[model samples]
Target: MVNSLSKRCISLLPIYKKVPWKSIVLHPIIHPRFKFTCWLAAWQRLATADRLLKIGVQVPLECSFCNNAMETVEHLFFDCSISKAIW
Candidate 1:
């Protein structure tokens, strides 16, 4: 047990939650742009309007489709009713 614990190779395995990539992001025929979008969405790093506004971009900061909430990456992609409908 001590030998296995001391092996650097054994410590290199992933220790985080597994991403569900096979069914979603790994289809051979899926468009590359869509794959990149999925990767960005997973990280909540998409440059939505609200994020741009905070960074000094001059885009409108309201959800254009929802019209009532701040247009953030999370709001536009996860919490908006329109986004839910599309998903």
Candidate 2:
């Protein structure tokens, strides 16, 4: 019964696609902390403000740097005016 239940749970999991940037993120020269961060970002699993609010944490939705838009991974990394300038 336990074996059957485990199989059922596994089958219910969403199948993820191959991550194209896996090699670059997991390169040996990359620092372990940076590698872990990059892996999370690649998976859209970084604890950005939008994700925090979705999980019911009370956080300001606006970007802390630009205060111009909702704080999402894309916005924080690429779209925010301050980040854009830094990049």
Candidate 3:
């Protein structure tokens, strides 16, 4: 199965491992299975593919913890005000 898929992406054969395939294709970083499901859901609510940057229609974009920097998918999970509080 891996070999068949690899053949389809032959042009990317050289540096596939370094390409963040899980994050780029499978979106594992965004859809983590268990531990961070709640956090992931929060991120999804904020930045679904069809809703990217269309913040005004939904909740405000400010960080819930800081009330400052825009609450993007990347920021909330990795670099936001509440992360420090939780840690």
Candidate 4:
């Protein structure tokens, strides 16, 4: 079984680590919505402009906050002027 190609590929695959559930869910300082948003952002699962383009949304790729930059996860979170102020 160990010598099989399937088992060999499985061994080469990287491990999937999970975040501590207590830290995200059980914490008092973090709001429930905030935790959900954080999880979505971490996974790059938010529907930003770039993702929209990939999914063929056919909309102009402009940052909703800054209107000068492409609306990507990084731009929306860190690079946009308005987001910078929010941070």
Candidate number of the best lDDT: 2
Considering every candidate listed, which one attains the maximal TM-score? Answer: 2
True-structure lDDT of candidate 3: 0.60
What ranking of all candidate models by TM-score puts the best one first? 2, 4, 1, 3
Candidate 4 lDDT: 0.85
Query: Once superposed on the true structure, which residue ranges of model 3 sit more than 4 Å away at CA?
Result: 1-56
Model 2 clashes, total count: 0
What is the C-alpha lDDT profile of model 3 across 1-87, one tens digit per residue? Answer: 999898889966576444333344455555455425554454465453235547445666577677768776666668876886687
RMSD of 2: 6.9
- What TM-score would each prediction reach against the true structure? 0.64, 0.74, 0.39, 0.67
Worst 10-residue lDDT window, candidate 1 = 17-26
The sequence of per-residue lDDT tens digits that candidate 2 reaches over residues 1-87 is 999999999999999987788898979999999999988888889988999988999988899999999999999888998998998
After superposition, which runs of candidate 2 have C-alpha atoms over 4 Å from their true positions? 1-17
Clashing pairs in 3: none
What's the residue-level lDDT of 45 in candidate 4? 84
Query: Cα RMSD to native, each candidate?
Result: 4.4, 6.9, 7.5, 6.9
lDDT preference between candidates 2 and 4, better one: 2
For candidate 3, which ten residues in a row score worst on lDDT? 16-25
